[model samples]
Every structure is written in structure tokens, then in C-alpha cells.
Target: MFKILVIDRCYFTRTGMESWLNQTDLFPASFLVAALHNLMLAKEHIVQWQPDLVIADLHGFKNEIHHIQQLASLFSVCGDGIKVLLLESGEDAQLSDYFTQFNIEETLLKTASLDTLAQSIDAIVLSRPTRTEPKPAVPLLTRQEEKVLTLWMEGRSNQSIATKLSINGKTVYTYKRNIRMKLGMDNRFTPFLSLPDAIN
Candidate 1:
């Protein structure tokens, strides 16, 4: 079974992608399309449901590269290991920092047809390579990072962690990015699924 998560604020975009997936001839039986309008809600599902691929609409991401870069980076990590497919306006297609910093699966221009999107999906999922061996274990986290990740897993929001630690919420997010990096997790990750083992 293939599970996909769609993140887009537009109702049409969300449904259209789902409809496309359903209608695609290349897609075999046993697929699920889960969607959320924004990243906040999607974050929980990405960690819990662990979708096979993620499709995000980056309509205005260029205006806020640093913040969006942080989001894209974390989203990339949260996919367990799968890269998020970014959809952007072709006008925003200029070479940019976002393109340079992140490992997006595929960048689809808005001009791209749903059929094109489906084909990209078919290509990525069907041709995905399998891992033959376990990756090296991720190194331990800094004590500060460990604290933040512990609270994050405990269902605390970034603001909550900031208050608890007397640090800025932005700093907390940086810690999250770092934690994701240190874990070096792949598609097989179940965030906090094995908290005791991960922390120790």
C-alpha cells in the first residue's frame, strides 16, 4: 500500500491532486491520499502516519526563504526519509536559495498538468530504490537538543518549549532542525516511536 500526504492551502489543489492520483492508470490498487491544508496539522500526521510521499504547494515560499527553508528542511526530515514534492509557480522558478539548500523530490511548475504530476508521482514511487543495509546509527544529541526533542515528542508546542527553557521559540525550531539532522533518519523513522531507545 502507498500512503501519500498532500499539503496545500487551496481546496481545489488538494482535491485535484487526490482526484488525479485516483484516476491515474499507472497507480495500482491499495493507495491512500491523506491531506491537510497547512503544515501544523500535517506535521503530526507525517510523524504518525508516515506517508510514502509528501506533496507541498510552495506558492509564496520565495518571499520568506529562511523561514520556508526551515519548514522545507524539517518537512523533508519528517517524511521519515522520503523527499517532499514541491509545487511552485513557474514564475517563482528563478534560481534561489531554497533550491540550493533543500532536497526536494521534484519541483513541479503550476503550469504542469495533473497528468504530468501523476507521471512524476508514478516515476518517483515506482522507481524508488530500496535500502540494503541499515544506515550508521545517528549520534547522540546535545543536552539542549535532547531536552527540546523530549518536550516536542511530549506534545508540547515550540512556544511551550521556549517558555519552559527560557529560550526563544525560533531557537527551539533551530534545535528541531538540528535534531532531525543528528538523527539522520530515513523513510523508516517513526518519530518518538522509540523514544526511550533514541534518547538513551
Candidate 2:
């Protein structure tokens, strides 16, 4: 079953989106859901329930484009396989940076067709590629260091990893920095994802 979360401040607006999805039979597949008014209100639920998609409104935030990028990244940081579908007002239609930075699954105008929204949501949730192929070991990394590398590459935040590994967050950060250096990675983001692909 696919899990979905809706984050919208306006009660009627939230219900309307939910009703439209249900009326369209949007995701013929199963969907378990939860809806809340804001990110802060539902963040813990997100980590615990692990929703497959998050339908959110960017209009609620300040400097909305940048906020959207960070919001999308939060899913990754929390180790949730949550794809984001963002809604924007017409005044701030262009959000290319969000696409480049976090690569959100979809973005639509607040006034978009329900059919389009359904297709967008369905496409992302159903078309995900599974990590079935065996990945070769990184020759450059020690087994322990590789543990750190794997967790970071999977997008766990430092504090999350610290708790998981029972190490200090600073140690996780140092390990991350070292892993980047060993990988010849000059900047954050794309290189970490690319290096593993190349090795595989």
C-alpha cells in the first residue's frame, strides 16, 4: 500500500484536495493517509509512518522556492522514501532551483486539473527504481568508513546517523568530510550519488 500525507494550512483546501483524489480514484493502488496543516505538526508522524508521497503547498512558506527545496530534502534526511508534489501560486510559478537542488517528483499550479495531479502522483510513486543489483565494494573505504558513507549517501542527517551508530554527530560530520575527500568530491550533492553509480 502507498502511504500519503497532505500538508496544507487551509482546512477546506486540504479536504478539497483529498476529496478530489478520492473522487478521481487517483491512485488505483492502495493508499494509507494522514493530513496535517503544516510540516512542524506532522514531522514526527512522517518519520514514524514513512509516507510514500507528500502533497504540500509551498505558498505557506517564506521565500517559497528555497523553502520548497529544504522541505523536499527533509524526507531524504529522515530516511523516508517520500516523494514530494509541491503546489505553487501563479505569482511564483518558476521553481527550477527546487528541481535541481532536491529533484522533487512534481510541481503544479494550485489551479491544476485533478487528472494531471493524479497522473503526476501516480507516476512518481509507481515508477521508482528498486536497488536490486549488487553494488561492488568501494576499494577506497574501510568497512567502518563505508558504513558512514552508505548512511550519508542514503541521505541520513548527521544527528540521525549519530543516534544510529552511537557516535557523536561531530564524528559523523568528520567521517563524511573524509569520505568526500577520499572520493575526490569537491562539492556536496551530485558527486556522492554519482561515485557509487560509477563504482557499480
| Local distance difference test scores for all models | 0.64, 0.62
Candidate 1 Cα errors over 4 Å, as ranges:
24-26, 60-66, 93-95, 129-200
lDDT of 2 at 11: 75
In model 1, what is the error at residue 172, expressed in angstroms? Answer: 26
Regions of candidate 2 where Cα sits further than 4 Å from its true position? 23-26, 63-80, 90-99, 128-200
Whose lDDT is greatest here? 1
Alpha-carbon lDDT of model 2 = 0.62
Q: What is the lDDT of residue 52 in candidate 1?
A: 67
Candidate 2: give its CA RMSD in angstroms: 13.2
| Candidate 2: tens digits of C-alpha lDDT, residues 63-138 | 4223355565455543536677887554454444544466477778778887787788778777664333323222
Worst 10 residues of 2 by lDDT: 191-200
TM-score of each candidate structure, all chains considered together: 0.55, 0.52
State in Å the error of residue 120, model 1: 0.8
